[model samples]
Target: MSTQAKRATIYFDPDIHKALKIKSLETSRSITDLVNQAVKEALSDDVEDILSFEERKNEPLISYDQMVKKLRKDGRI
Candidate 1:
């Protein structure tokens, strides 16, 4: 455990809690380690999503009516 790690009170559903316990025993890892890794992965995905949005922030915005018109023009609607 890292000395700088903070403590949190998290609640999990009974089924998930049981699964975590089983996984911990099988993998010889702590529940905290598994949860931390999951959280890190989730946050990393969020960061990637945010970066994607930022990259597209200046892209064109098409209105619903305009989209429908284009679809009609292209015989796609």
Candidate 2:
């Protein structure tokens, strides 16, 4: 069963609106559908990143001074 989409109006610059319309026509999807999909993907990726950082939070901490000293010794600074 497909979900029914709601109607909403958003204002965009004329050129952006034209480009979006053209892309929508070429891709055979509505502008709303494209925008919703993009937002969903971005949110999902952020969630993944948050989980990754939480997993690594306790690994280690390096001071800036120590990092610079090491870099200088290694001729990387």
Candidate 3:
């Protein structure tokens, strides 16, 4: 409702739009806020995965069966 807010239109099914509107009213937050928060959470998860992958960049890749066999051989099973 801010005069300085930017307007962008997104398409949704009628039912979905209705649900979002109801949720917005129930939560006392704008649709933009809900969408922005969800998007931010998704992007943050992706960033976490990227960082985790980078940290494990030097880890040796092993298949599931290979791992089981190795564990059995090592008597660690």
Candidate 4:
């Protein structure tokens, strides 16, 4: 991992880019900082999701149709 940040070019939809610019100005933060923080948060969420899936890897699988049938049989549907 590099301590220094590397520069990369990313494209955003026109409307989203406009919103980011407005948000950056309103927050008194650079667009770079906001974008980096958003990216970091998203990546963190992904890591958490992966860990949760790994932890639940051995759980049983059930189908939607089976669940509905069971519910109907139990008179709960």
Candidate 5:
């Protein structure tokens, strides 16, 4: 978290907005904090996925049809 924050305008569905309000009250946190945390977590997941792809960049690629045939041969599909 940073001491300074940026502001943005976001629109949510009515149900989602209501849910956020309820969660904020129950958790004693502001909607801004909750949304920021969620966004940070999503970005972290993306970073992880990118790192994983880079790590396995040299692995052989398998086509979908090939994969299905292999699975059937192995009695897995």
Candidate 6:
């Protein structure tokens, strides 16, 4: 967490807002902290996916039709 924080207005659905308030009281943490953590986790997953795609970028590509045919031939579909 940073000592200095920026403020922003976020509108959450009524049910979600109620859930966050309950979670905040139960965990003794602010809604902002929970939202920030969730955002960070989502961004981290995206970065991992991007890296995986980069690693497989040079692999041979297969079309959907070709894949189904191959699967049928292999008796796996």
Top TM-score prediction, candidate number: 6
- Which rank order by TM-score, best down to worst? 6, 5, 1, 4, 3, 2
lDDT ranking, best first: 1, 5, 6, 4, 3, 2
Q: lDDT per residue, candidate 5, 1-77, as tens digits?
A: 55888779999999999999999999999999999999989999999999999999999999999999999999998
Model 3, C-alpha of 75: deviation from truth (Å): 5.3
Q: For every model shown, what is its TM-score relative to the native structure?
A: 0.84, 0.71, 0.72, 0.81, 0.87, 0.91
Error of 5 at 8 (Å): 0.3
Candidate 2, residues 1-77, lDDT tens digits: the string is 16877778888899988999999999999888888888789999999999999999998888999899999999997
lDDT of 6 by residue, 32-66 (tens): 99999899999999999999999999999999999
Whole-structure CA lDDT of model 6: 0.96
* Candidate 1 residue 46 C-alpha distance from true site, Å: 0.4
lDDT of 2: 0.90
Task: Report residue 61 deviation for candidate 5 (angstroms).
Answer: 1.1
lDDT of 6 at 23: 98
3 or 4, greater by TM-score: 4
* lDDT, residue 27, candidate 3: 100
After superposition on all C-alphas, the RMSD of every candidate to the true structure, in Å, is 1.7, 2.5, 3.2, 2.3, 1.4, 1.1
Report the C-alpha displacement of residue 32, candidate 4, in angstroms.
Answer: 0.7
Q: At residue 67, give the lDDT of candidate 5.
A: 97
The residue-by-residue lDDT of candidate 4 on 4-47, one tens digit each, is: 87889999999999999999999999899899899899999999
Candidate lDDT scores, in order, read: 0.97, 0.90, 0.91, 0.93, 0.96, 0.96
